[model samples]
Target: MTRALYSLCGADERHFFSPHCWKAVMALAHKGLDFEEVPTTYSRIVDIGGGFSKTVPVLDDNGRLISDSFDIALYLEDTYPDRPSLFGGEGGKALSRLVEGYSQMMIHPAIMRIALLDIHSILDEGDKAYFRASRESRLGKPLEDFAAGREAEREAFAAKLEPMRHMLRFQPFIGGESPLFADYIVFGALQWLRIAAGLAMLAPDDPVMAWFERCLDLHESRGRTVTAA
Candidate 1:
C-alpha cells in the first residue's frame, strides 16, 4: 500500500497552506518518503482517521492512520531510523518540540488572525462558514475588524521572532549545520503566511528569510511547487 498524507489546502486544492500540513510534508521529504497527497480542509477533518481524528496532517502510512503533525514526525523517525534524520538525536528531539511549541503558540495565532480574511476567501463555502464562526469566536470580533489591526499584529509578530533571529544569525538552520524537524516546525509558519496571505511577515533583512528560501529548495523545491491561495 502506498503512503498517503491528508493535507489541508484551500478551495483551489493546489493551495496547500496549513502549517501543520507543511510540517508533515517536510518531514516526509526529509525521510525520503514518497506519499500520495490527500488535500482536505478543517470542515472535513472529522471524516479522516475513521472519525478518531479531527485535524489535518493525518498520515496514512500504508494503512495505519496517524494524526497530529508532530506525532507523524516522531513516527517517521521511529519507523524509518535509517532514512535521513528528522531530529538529529534525543537532544534534538527535545529541542524540536520547543520549536514546534513556539511556532504553534507564539507565531501561529498572530498570523492566523492576520490572514483570517484571506484564508476565508480561499476556503470552500462550508469550510468558510466553519472557519468564520470558530475564528470569530476566538478573535471575539468580525474578521474584517480583526484584519484592520493586522499591520500592528504583524509588527508584533516580527518582534516576537527577535530571539529566533538572534539564534539564526549564527546557525544556518535550527539543527545547527542542517535543517531538521525543528526547522520545518518553524518554517511551516512562514510557509503558512506566504501561501495564505502572501504577506511579508518578516523584514527584508531578516535571517529567517534566507533559511526559508533554502527550505523551499529542499525535495526539488517541493514547498515552492505547491500553489499559493
Candidate 2:
C-alpha cells in the first residue's frame, strides 16, 4: 500500500513549501499515515493528475488520485475512520472550513507579498521563469515590483493575526485541546512563510508562536524535517 503525495518544491526537491501542500502533508501525518513525497515543480503541475488539476498536493492514494488540500483531508478522514480524526465531527468540519477561509483569504495574501521574491529565488531555473511569467501575468506586475516594500509589510501582516493570537491565548490550538485540521490550516500558512521567507511572522513571546512550536513537535516532529528557508 504505497501512498504518494505529489508535493510542490523549489530548486531543492527537499524543500516542499506550498501552503496547501503542507495542509495535506500534516493531515496525512495526523492520520498516522506514511507517504512518499514526489517533488513537483511549478512547471511540472500539468504532468500530474492527467492534467485534471493545476496544483500540487495531489495525493495518489494507491492509484486513487485526490487533488485539492481540503478535498484530500475529507478523503483521509472518511477512508481512515479508525485513525485520529482531522475534524472531530460535523461542527468541527464547519469550523475547520471557517479557519481555512480565514487563512486563505487573510493570511496567504500577506505572506505572498513578503515571500514572493524569496520564493522566486529558491526555485529551479525552469520553475523560476515559469513562476515569474505566470505570477506576473496574474498579478499584473513584475515579481520584484509586487514584492516591493516587503519589510514594511511585516507589521501589517502581524496585525492581521490578532484573531489567531486571541484564540491561542485561551487554548493551545485552534482546534481546542489538541491540534485538528483547523490548526494545520494556519500551520500551513506560517510554515509557508517560514520556509519561503525565512522570516518570523510572530514575536517570540507570542502565544501563537508557542502553538506553532507545539505543532512542529507533532507526529514525531514532521514539520521540522524541512528547515526554514
lDDT of each: 0.86, 0.90
Could you tell me the TM-score of candidate 2? 0.97
lDDT at position 45, candidate 1: 83
Over 4 Å off in model 1, which ranges?
A: none
lDDT of 1: 0.86
Residue 108 in model 1: shift from native, Å? 1.0
lDDT of 1 at 195: 85
**How well is each residue in 1-229 modelled by candidate 2, as lDDT tens digits?**
8899999998999999999999999999999999998999988889986786788889999989999999999999999999999999989998788899999999999998999998889899999899899999999999999988787888688888889889877888888899999999999999999998765756788777788899999989989989997
Tens digits of per-residue lDDT for model 1, 60-156: 9988889899999999999999999998899999988788778889988888768878878888898899988988898799889889988888778
Clashes of each: 0, 0
List of clashing residue pairs for candidate 1: none
lDDT of 2 at 134: 91
